[model samples]
Target: MNSSWNPTHGWEDLVSAALVGTDRRPLPSGAATPEAELFDHAALLTVRARAGQTPREGRPLEAAPQERQPEVSRAAGDRLARILGGERPRLLTEWLQAAAARGHRLSPHLLPELLDQAARDRSIRPHLGVLAGARGRWLAGLNPAWGFLLEEVTAPGAAHETWELGTSGDRKAHLGAVRAADPARARHLLEETWEKETPQDRAAFLEILADGLSLDDEPFLENALDDRRREVRHEAADLLTRLPGSRLALRMAERAAACLHTENGELHIAPPLACDAAMERDGVRAKPPRGTGERSWWLQQIVARAPLEIWPRLFGRPPGELVRMKIPDWGREVMAGWVRATVLQGDPEWARVLFAWDPLADLLAVLPRKDREDVAAGFVRRHGLDGQLIMVLGGAAAPWGPDLALAVLEKILQVSGTQPWNLSELSRLAGERIDPALYGMAERLSPEPPIQEVAALLRFRDDMLKELQ
Candidate 1:
């Protein structure tokens, strides 16, 4: 209240009094300031200072790099908002793929949100780089949360430094980038530090080999089979299996050939007597899972890792013919291993044959999408409505064609009343994957509880798809 009182002179004293409590350390007493008046004045000044505060002007942000593509339409932007808001996140990958195919860039305002989304869901990151455009990459450089994106845009020289001196994640990103550019070099880089890396790090680095997998990588992978770590051995075996001509596959094929043969036009299989040291060295685990016979477990591993080409040559029959032949109980176990191998190797022709023998979900997914749908359609028609058919259909890609859609609808209508529980999950899958064009067909279903719920979900999905479009 004094005309010439400077608040700065007693500011420290005032803060100390406030910290220790004015009861213990009474407010500074002076001619112009009584304790009661001092408290009131301090309160008034605090309120005034807070109310009068203004944000300091920051330096202007640098201009964003020029975007090559035009911004997406307002409708498309709105669709992205809905997708990011979790209305139908499952369709995000499809939407991103579609948008990237159309050569449209996301709106500038959405770049941060999209990058944040990519950070949380890494599956979308590969597609996001292109769709996010120049502005997104520019924004990513300024934010640590989004720094992963910068790896994609960084210069080759700078990326090399990041790979050499940065954290494990940064190094992995650099390795991925290098692998995409020159696969052999990536392998060389990893090999340089292979001995120094921990077992877990070694296993993780081995995964990068999958990116540029080829017969050229076979020798390194074959040597990795003898790694001290079981995981490294398993990973090496998995990669080697992908290369039919790899030495490991040849050994497996030879082992499988010795165990399996056709006798008098019927298949016969002799399970391995023991999991020998050689088999274990090649990545076969010595211990069987609980309740599994040791020989059967060993046989499964041998057959599953053997190259698909081995069967037709060894049995002198095409895959389709061999799969249909009658097999002894032990032979069935061997065939199951072959089926698993088909899925693991992604041998579509073998998968197609095995699916015909037994329409398993894993085999179905391995076949080409069109072949998968056709096979599923046939199975649905032959077996009538069942859980297996629903599973195959559920795993198939979305926007189910007219024939598959109608087949599914007919099957749903046929069994809706009897299998309510199965139909509940089937209906949900139908909503997610069925073509919106089949709305009228879905609407025509009888108003039973199952059909009613499915119809509602279909309508909601239709709306969600339309918004995304």
Candidate 2:
């Protein structure tokens, strides 16, 4: 016996004897049976370990502030529970958005689960400010994990004290609120502390300016282009490029004008011979990616950053006519650059023309909601079922109107027999996107497994949304 062995200090010795067996390592005390003695010591150790500690007294918790907004319908809370339980979890955002829109707060029982969900998926956090209400914020203060709830609450015209003393997120939310209300004031406020801010903070604060960008911001953005950090310079140049009249845009337009021109009703090509220092300063990268040629990269950057309006003026044609014109050489490169410009400038005229030339999914963002469906349906008809067709459909606005729903459903049925495998993704998209009102029509589409799955999902969504109301 190791006379020193006791429950308080020799727990490991007791465990070692039990692990090594009675013959190899004797029990702490010679007894009737080694197993019995070992069990007795382990039991005593367990009891001592549990009873030795008392529950430490915790500070009294502050009561959660009362939430004034009415609670959502009992049915809606049950639907949220089902969503949290993994029944169509993607619809959780829709449930939260709808509940908040109707001025309803979540029931107290569901706040923890939802806060945990928002912690995982940031996209839903924006909707939580209203839906989670005052109680959620109070709950967030007690737990570090739910701190996002506190950050999301931007009191209108937040006091200057938040910017001066609050956490990083608090300062950002405060600056964003000010920016939303007055762009110039936000700019001035940021300038006051710009020199003191770290590179990362400078870059993040600069992005908030994007929400309400104007010509008034050009001087500040231009100064930022000279910032020591590469990220700061990159962000500044991007903002300037989006501002059509910025000096950087003008430089890019001039450089592009010298490279491309029209003659004999065909567009000509003249990519830059070299990427100059000025071009680099204005945000053009001199080095190309692994497979891209240097001159081709320069050409793409020049055309992309140049204002889209420049084409109509220099080419003596509207965007539609210019997009249709032949480009004998660098055809792909030129069109690709134009596509970049269309997205950055958000030129619907150019986006419409570019889509007519080539039905790109990226162009859909600039089109109106109705136009998106119309153009996407037209593309599905013209291109038929293929990878590109699926890519185009992905960009179209959801709760897809009848035209696109019918067009896609027809396409799915038309090709179901020949291409059952391809129909799965298309069918899933249809089920998820097509308006719930059209559930009956979708159910009648076909008896094929993919179509049947689509019908089932549509019906589920229909019921899901009804519960929210």
Candidate 3:
């Protein structure tokens, strides 16, 4: 009865008996289970053994997925090119795999035209990262195909994106070496080509800095704070303020301190007002009016660009006073706009302060869930839905209806759970209100899970039959 068992599980006694007659001799390394007995005598590679399997514990529910970048970009780009160049469809995928093995960068000029041709042949498509992410130039945003790369690189697996760094004798060790202190170098590299890069490429390249902001990039970024292109200036300034020590912080603080005061034992500065000469020279430009004051949208942008550190100094008092200061009645919308800006910049110390303001709190408290849903939904559609959707789910799902979440799930899950970073984000975003159905789909789609068909995912299909009763 050859068997497998842990050597520590009283296997010696069983082995002695088996050797005498039952032939159940345990391997020196393993228990006396029938398989282990065979392993003992069969010159098996039963190196290490555990006495028992660990029991399973439940994990949280569904999270919208985050897509991978780069690796999938390489894969899809190569495949689409091969198909466009007239290879068989199957051969295109094979060639793509081969190209990925060889480590090739898709020629930016060739990728789109190739994708267009492949589309005509019906062999390649949106699946091609090189095409989907190519905003006619540099790849911006996550390609649904490659979204798993960062997740895989950052954390090992707890979710589907899990991968071993240097197994299988691949080139991962070299890749790891290059990525060892990647954050700083990569930002500099972007700065190197910032001027020559197209507007789309500029946006794409600048966004990468956001993923891993470093103070080391501050000098170059500060130069960009006043860039001719508004988009470049906006994103660059935003990234810099993320680092608390930058000059913008001190400047913003100066402005904020100047704004507030308690005159004769009462508050003075108006809470919201037009960005008069004092405000503009100070960096608060009343612009882009969506209402009575400058456009709420423009006010949001300028406030977001002005460092939160400025508020205390600009007001000549603390945030509590700033919140209490009077404003042109219409300024309520403008300040609320500023509060929303703080959320995107995501500086907690500042957001917490703004978050606590009674006026800001009141607006959020009474705001319609539908309005928030619509607003955020607009962002999701504009940006890639995968990562953003996960963020929303982690928060109050609210009365926005299950359909919004379901749509986000259906759209984003197609690329979920393949990478490590995405998995970590997924876990964070789903929090406790995870949707079980989405979780099941994630499991089934897991790279390690057995392939299974999911009936509910009819999102990507082009053909649907409607039966009218």
Sort the candidates on lDDT, descending order.
2, 1, 3
RMSD of each: 9.2, 6.7, 24.9
Rank ordering of all candidates by TM-score, starting from the highest = 2, 1, 3
lDDT of each: 0.75, 0.82, 0.43
Q: Which stretches of candidate 3 lie over 4 Å from their true place?
A: 1-127, 130-180, 262-287, 290-292, 295-302, 309-334, 349-469
lDDT of 1 by residue, 42-108 (tens): 7656654433222235865678888777677788788778877887676678777767656577887
Candidate 1: minimum summed lDDT over ten consecutive residues — where?
47-56
Count of clashes, each model: 0, 0, 48
Q: Please give the TM-score that candidate 1 achieves against the real structure.
A: 0.64
TM for candidate 3 is 0.39
Model 2, 83-159: lDDT tens per residue? 89998786777777777667678888888778877889899886787678788887777666777777663332346
* Segments of candidate 2 deviating more than 4 angstroms: 1-60, 100-104, 117-120, 128-149, 153-213, 263-266, 273-277, 324-329, 440-456
lDDT of 3 by residue, 1-469 (tens): 2344443444455556556644444244445355555436433222211111222258532332332323334445444555556743433443333333333334455544544444355433322332222232222212222232222112121222121232111122222332344876565545565676666546545666666666777787777765667677667766765665777655654444344445564544434444554434333445653444354443444455556555666446666566566664434554664575465456444444554452232223223466444444444454443543555444435323344444444344534544323443433333222233344444444443211222122211101111000
Who wins the TM-score comparison? 2
Candidate 2 global TM-score? 0.75
Q: Distance from true position, residue 228, model 1, in Å?
A: 3.0
